[model samples]
Target: MSRYETRLEDYRRRERPSYRVFEGMQELVCSVGQLHNNWLYVNVDQWDQDPVHTPIYYLDEHWLEECAEDGTAATNEQDEYIPLWISDRQVQTWFELATFESVVEVLKAAGKPVTLQMVIVAVKYYDKRDAYLDYDEVKAVTDLWFVLTKVRNHLTE
Candidate 1:
């Protein structure tokens, strides 16, 4: 019915989040970066937009619980902003963006002032399980499962 309802449904249906092959169901959080390229990767709520400076009063801790209780009614309590975890793959994307110099170009296109500091965020999902594990039985969830690289040039500094 509403966006929250849709997300809740999606979560309920998805027991596993990432789209990869894993040995088993292991809930983990690791700080990772790409060696080939420097990018900061993080896990976040896929639906939330880029982080804002101010404290997002819109979302509270109980917000997620509310969604769990009632998705359609909890639409207003949604606050999927804060990132849950970070990964290394995201750094690779930043490295690519930097190599192409597209990062600066993108900011300019969006009218966002180019700065030495930047935060890139992406939302993705994964489905990984062992051969013995049934795809339907193993389910996990992840948000912003991509790398977000930030780079600042000399001019910005």
Candidate 2:
């Protein structure tokens, strides 16, 4: 069987119920553009499906504490850059789950600027781990920030 088929079969056998809810959904769909540069342009609005996605959890360094049981956790200078599309989603999701005040706090907690690129990187490589964020995962986090920002900005204006 092909890699995709194998993965599908393995996924079917897994017992994790949470992952199952978003099973079989496409992660990303690409749109072709006739740009001069060799780059792919993805439209966040063109996602496969719309659902309630959020980043209700914090990126605590404790989750991977076990890996450093014998000593302090190893650190690395692994910087990541998330595509602009995912960043917008993060802002959207944040807008939905919290009020303008709360959203601003979360953004502050996450650090300043709150740029689209930074949000995308958070989703793609949040807390310097969990590289494989599936579509639904991305959607939830994006939705939270996306909605929150709108509300936050409106309140300010």
Q: Which candidate is the best by lDDT?
A: 2
Q: Which stretch of 10 consecutive residues in model 1 shows the poorest summed lDDT? A: 25-34
Scored against the true structure, residue 30 in model 1 reaches a CA lDDT of 11
Residues 86-141 of candidate 1 have per-residue lDDT tens digits of: 12212111122122233333334555343222322211111111112112212211
Top of the candidates by TM-score = 2
TM-score of every candidate: 0.18, 0.25
Candidate 2: how many backbone clashes? 24
Question: Tens digits of per-residue lDDT for model 2 on 1-20?
Answer: 99999867755663321111
For each candidate in the order shown, give its overall lDDT on alpha carbons: 0.25, 0.33
Show where candidate 1 strays beyond 4 Å: 1-36, 46-50, 53-101, 109-157
Local lDDT at 46 for model 1:
26
